[model samples]
Target chain A: MSDWAQLKQALISGDGEELCRRVRQTLDQGVSAKDILNQALIPAMDVVGERMENEDMFIPEVLMAAKAMSAAVEILKPLLAADDLSAAGKVVIGTVKGDLHDIGKNLVAMMMESAGFEVKDLGVDVAPETFVAAARDNGAQLVCLSALLTTTMPMMKETVAALESSGLRDKVKVMVGGAPVTRAFAASINADGYAPDAGSAAKLAKSLVQ
Target chain B: MKSKGRRGGIYRPLTQDQVETIHDAALTILERVGFTYESGLDDLLEMLEGSGARVDREKARIAFPRSLVEAQTAKAPNRVILYGRSEDSHLDLQDDLVHLGTGGAAIKIVDPENGTARPSTLKDVYDLARLVDKLDNIHFYLRPCIPTDIPEAAYDVNVFYACFKGTRKHVMAGVNNEKSFHDVLELAALLADGMDALKARPFFSIITSFAISPLKFCTQSTRIMREANRHGIPVALSCAPMAGSTSPITMAGTLAQIHAEQLAGITVCQLTQPGAPVLYGGIPGMANLKTMGYLGGAVECGMMNAAIHQMAAHVGVPNYNSAGLSDAKIPDAQAGWEKALTIVLAAMGGSNYVHHAAGMLESMLAVAYEQFVIDDEIIGMSCKVLEGIPVDADRLALEVIESVGPGGNFMTSPHTMAHLHDEYFEGNGITDRKSRPKWEKDGAADAWARARRLVERLLSGEETPYISESLDRQIRERFEILL
Candidate 1:
């Protein structure tokens, strides 16, 4: 098989080391960085995501494939142009203030990154100002807020207000999620979208940006 | 509600010969493979050693001989009555009598007010019990959620107190430790007027998950089981082994392994106190191979749980099995279908003491209040199915049918009026049966929305405690009552 096929196989199988090695091998075989990425890594993750949606693949496997995809992209970063790196648009994400839950937030971030968005994850207990500033600095088109506690759900509304006051609300879409946040709550907070889980979060983020 | 402890066993998934084969295989497993105990349970090991079991002290393994297993199994009472607070609510488990209720130690609940998943608190425990008390179709109240708001030391007493405060149904829960177990017994004694009175009725029972899967015993839960047995409290030996991860991959193999585990627990319980009231608790489910998560809503899980009822019957013990689980995040169509299929199968297969029959979602990780209301309707229908058509001379309505023969209407017949409430199963109004115009005029609410409204209506006007004020105050003085 071709070198790109080998790289795709390794990435889908979650063999990160073999994936990176095959990336180098494909580069040595006179392949352009853009061709290797668009032809192999991106398509491999698309398959992984589809498999996940179809229940053929699960969260751990999808995360492993996402990790491998990032590692392969890292090797091709220097060779590719700046705009080509984030072809799917940039995003700012965080777990809102007073909420120390980041496992769900991290999963959504990884899924979004694998979906080709450049995600700047502002970890747990992030203030609304931090979210606004990160969105502005990253020139992001989307911001995803997560809160796992009922008490901290107000921070999601605060983050939305901060984005509106910062004059970035019209420029970017605000999506809220976590265990306690609902679609009606998202609408009540005047956010753009809400997704129940990580897989749907990535899909919703893509649609919101579009 | 109309038919409590209805005779089921109409839908047998396994043949008599197949059940005997599984039983024989389980006996062989106990005789050869045996079980390993944790290091600190040497006293339990010594007890087993004295009861004609070969003990490998070096490996902490106690292998039961076939004769010892048979003798111990025979010592357990076949018909165990889990007494409710009132005589009317007692659950009689014998001869394929089925009782379905709630069970889980879920950490999260879909908040009833806002429809968001949140950490389940002590109030949720009490509130859910109140719901169970009002819903006639849900027969008993197993402690559904853990009180995440309390300290670990206060968990057992507070949870039991919250359950007792909310409902008069037979309450069952797992204790945190031996001290808490004793504390709860004292608290029950206080409520029942005396220790002898409490022991005589046993308004509460203990669920001891003594056996780990694949022939291993959990140390703390085993100690709790021994104490419960000695105290003459009914205990369920809960052994949940996932098909692929914990036990064998095939259904029969999983059943064999779980059966062996149950036999081991029964042997220990009978050895501790002869003729102890024990349940053959077998919660066997297949693993989601991709994620290795417990697949609680799988139809195969329903099949295995149904088959476990037959296995328990073969061993002459009332079983504590599971059904009515849904993996759906909300009370949607997926949740409805998954829960209905499994619950009906278990009920038809005659699973006594069926828990997780209501208020569970996301494979027992979380529960939705609306789901409980919805599942009550489903379980009522299952019990109706279990009641099965009673065809006799007068019930066949031969003369009445001949009188109303070809072109007559029996809508206003005396026979119709006499059998109206008894014959047909009128659901608890959660299900909609209206024209499009009528449904639209009523806001076109789905099952979830309707169930939500029902839940709101039930919990809104309730502040009555099940226990008396004097007893509550006395118990409060004696223990740290968080509720």
Candidate 2:
């Protein structure tokens, strides 16, 4: 098989070490970093996403593939142009203040990154101001808020208001999610979109940016 | 409501020979592997050494002989009655008599209004107890949530006080230490008018989680267990060994290990005070190897717990095992099926005190108010399964069939009218059976929404404290009743 095909198979099989070695080898063979990322990594991740949506791939396998894809991307990062990165979108994500849950938020971040979005994860217990500052600094097109507690859901609303008050709300699409967050809750809080889980969150983010 | 303690050994997950083999394996484990204790439990070590156990002082491990284990297992009471303040709420745990109740020390509760979790507080404890009081199918009220809002020193008393104030059902909770155990007992005595009367019925019980998994005893809990047994207070010797992490991964292996741990605990309790009331508390769970977390709702967990009931029965003691748990974070379809599958198996296998059967969600990390209401219906249905088809002459309805011969309608028959409520399991309004149009007219509420409405109605209806005015005043006077 060709070098790109070998790299793609390594990523789909979730062999991070093998994928990174192949990325280095393909680069040595005069393959452009951007070509490797676009032709091999992104397509492989797209296949992984489709498999996940089809229920052929579960969370663990998807996560492994995401890890392998990221590892290969890390090896190609220095050679690729800045504009070549984040070809999908720039996004900021976090668990709202007073909510220390981050597992769901982290999953969304990983899935988004694997889907080619540049995710700046402002970890758990993140304040509205921190989210606003991160969105402003990153020039993010989308902001995702997560809150596992009912008490901290108000923080999600406040973060949205902060973004609006910061005059960045019109520029950024705010998406909300968590265990307790519903579509009605998202609409009530004036969020631009809502997704029940991580995979759908990534899909919604892609569509929102479009 | 049907009676609580119905005979329920209909579904034996383990055969009689399997039970014997497991029992013999447990005996071998106790005789050979032994159990390790903390260094400071000098009294416990001395007692075990005096009672025919081989104690390696340097190792702080005590190995029981087969004869000692057999003798101590025989000493445990065949019957244990966890009495409620109201006489009708008593749970008679003996033979294959089955009772299901709430059990956990979860730190979070899903808010009833908005379907999200918050740190559980003292008020949540009282409120859940009150909810359990009104739930007919939940036979007892084990403290379901921790009062995180209270100070550590005040936790035990306040939790017991809240439960006592909220429900007259037989309340059980884990104590912090020997001091807290005495304080809770004193509080129960004040409610019972004296310590002697309180001891007689012991409306409340202690769940002494004395053993850490894998043949090790926690120091403080062991002390508390000894004190509880010495006072003739009913105690459940809780030893939960996570399969693949704490105990062996195989079901039979986990059973063998937990059985030995329980036998070790029983030996200790009997040696402390001969014939002390104790329940074989075997809460065996699987480990989510991905996260190394407790997998409470697996069918294997239910099967192992059901097998534990058989092991306890073999040793001639009532068992306190777990079922009706779910990994689902919400009261959705996953939660419903997981809870139902585990609970039915545990109840059918005749677990004497099946807990974690109500209100628990998120793998015992959280409880929801609506979930409790929903689980009440689930428990009601499981109990119906335990009731089984009484295949007698009356239930066979031979004469009634003859009377309603030739395709006659039984719906209009007097026999149908007589056995209407008695025969079938009348659910508690949570299950939706309405036609499509009628359901749409009623706003199409799902089980969660229906249960939430029931919760709101029950919580708002009235404020009837289980404790009387005088008793409340007396309890407040003596104790710092935070609830």
> What fraction of the reference interface contacts is present in each model, in order?
0.38, 0.00
The lowest-lDDT stretch of 10 consecutive residues in candidate 1 chain B is B286-295
lDDT per residue for candidate 2 within B436-477, as digits (tens), equals: 999999999999999999998888868776788988888888
In model 1, residue pairs whose N, Cα or C atoms come closer than 3 Å (at least 3 residues apart or on different chains), thus clashing, are none
Tens digit of per-residue lDDT, candidate 1, span B373-431: 99999999999998777899879999999989899999988999989888889988998
Which candidate number has the best DockQ?
1
Model 1, docking class: acceptable
Separate clash counts for every candidate: 0, 0
Q: Write the per-residue lDDT of candidate 1 for residues A50-148, one digit (tens) a residue.
A: 676566886667778888888888999999988776788899999999988887799789888877788899999999999999999999999999998
